[model samples]
Target: MGLWLSCVALSSADVRISVTNGAAACPCLGPAKHTPYTTMRRMTTRSTSGRPRIAVVGTGGTIAGAGNAADGAPSAAYTSAVTGADALIAGVPALARLADVQAEQLLQIDSADFTDAQLLLLARRVVALCVRDDVDGVVITHGTDTMEESAYFLHLTAHSAKPIVLTGAMRPGTALAADGPANLLHAVAVAAHPSSVGRGALVVMNEEVHSARDVAKVHAMRLDAFASPHGPLGLVVEGVPRWYRAVTRPHTTTSEFDIAAIDALPLVGVVTSHGNMRREIYDAWVAAGARAIVHAGFGGGTVPEYLKPVLAELCAAGVPIVRCSRVGAGPVIRNASFDDDAAGSVAADDQNPPRARLLAALALTRSQGVGEMQRIFNRY
Candidate 1:
């Protein structure tokens, strides 16, 4: 009898058990072994000191948006950035089980209206949070339209290895089958995970995790809107994150770009090269004081035959021009057929035009040399 009771205790301890809402009881241990289940319940309801401290910063995107319909039908016409960060956090009760979560509202606007000033402020705030000893990780709720841009911006400037994850939703919070709560919960899980350290900035959406540099909002209205042209880093399954690969490029603490020293970024514009494009558009940008231009060239970053001379003139006048592809995916090889090596022009390598413009602006802040700019593109 003694041997049998000892075996029962050992076997019950070894078996994984989950008791939800005090409804399910362990069959082996009875009332005497209920202490472990009670402990687990306490752990889930409140975070202990051992839990990772995660700060959730909300910038007001579709995830927090609400609709006006009395029936609570999801509507894209609703105002964005309407919900506060605390409410967003409260909406996801599962997140409380993963980390010690706190939230703060940063801004509330449609991402299409996001400006450079707002980007700068957001980066500074992220840097501040990452440096704190009390905070283990940070997550930003953002609009998907420009989420990639903001993520990449933080990837380049944030000087910490602590995880920074960005997430958003296509439908409003009031919509049926809203993805915001799930995305937010997964983002918090990723941010609190130990493996996420040194991964630079990340985008978590629709169960997939992507590096900031490669992730983009490819679809307009689908739940699976974000994807990386290269491939995602990993995915979240059953509230646990699994990473498949690591980012190779220099980022965070390894990056030379620092947000602390930069008060204002230089003006950079993207111009699409098309059939029969005129020179006045190029000249007008220069006249408006654009320090650099990212030419979204056709098919492998080729400048239109007509605009080549104008671009060369702009380069000679100390306005750096970067050649990037409008083809969406693929690298823009340097010294291509249309490249003017003598004019100090540089290629954007694999970066898209919008990202190229951001890099050009940051590179210009450090140096205007063509070689230095090219090196920045290659390294970052």
Candidate 2:
């Protein structure tokens, strides 16, 4: 009888970080899967009047979870947990009096599902919103998965002077202990702070702030999984943000990819490098009609010698090839090892794959030549 009781007690142990609420199991999101976010409904929270009009854009993630109790044990606490955009706002008490917020469901997608079209669409929404006299800033609810990519996309495209901050959750809001609420609330506080302006798009996660271009999902499963490859740009504590570094790339309220100026861009491909390779993929892209290819090369942008000829052929064919390193820790510089005689393509040495792809496509759309695109990438 004693053994039976002990076993039962041991089965119900506190997992995850025990918070004021309760404990969720180790995987926090139990058999986590990629499911679209729930639909947007009229979620009511206390609102403030005479505050700067701020737009709350909901893109989707664990922040909008909907799970049932039957899926777990008896003491599994709440059977079903549901969180809305309004709930994200309410979680942080600091935002209620600071801004008049309006929630808009831009898209209900896991950040992993984000695509080029979605990036453009979100940028367009931001561009339209920032010009309004009543609108002071923009806040986004995103999945930590690919939050950085989307954030960087907005940073390069939106060109806004107002604060544009993206927030995400490592654990679902339904979990006994979730990080979504705090992260969302902090993002709102960051957005509403006048001092937050002019920093370009920012990612506020786990109390650490990062410039979008530098941040990446470094850990697979931790509340504090995200990290900026170049270290944090700043941090947030007690509802206030403090900065220490500057944004190095061209961004925010100043960029060549203006919202109204761009319409259609050429098709650009990013090929990641690894040991022992083939030119088949490059040839395939060229055969299938790729206008340009961003080579995510190995270690400071070095490509296999066997593939160099194919790259040269692509360049000779008038298709641009932009060299960017796959390692992503540093820039990809132009030289002989990465490119033979700098013949066929331009270098994306200083930019990540996403940024490189953006620059390549934009360059192709504008100048329509490899040399011109190279100059544009360098200038930007």
Best by lDDT: 1
Candidate 1 runs further than 4 Å off = 1-47, 71-74
The candidate 2 region of ten consecutive residues with least summed lDDT is: 1-10
Q: Model 2, 1-380: lDDT tens per residue?
A: 00000000112221111111123322321211221111111111213443446788888776665455346632223312245677667665555545677788888777767777877788899888887766778998887777877888778778777889998877676565677777876777677654566878999999888888778887866878888777887777445555678786678777777767777667788899888888888888887888988888888888788888788888888877888878767776777576535566787756778778877877766788666787777766
Badly placed stretches (over 4 Å) of model 2 are 1-50, 68-84, 90-94
TM-score of each: 0.87, 0.80
Model 1: how far is 165 from its true place, Å?
A: 0.4
lDDT of each: 0.81, 0.70
Q: Can you write out model 1's per-residue Cα lDDT over 283-342, one digit (the tens) per residue?
A: 888888999888899988998677778889999998989998987778888877675587
TM-score of 1: 0.87
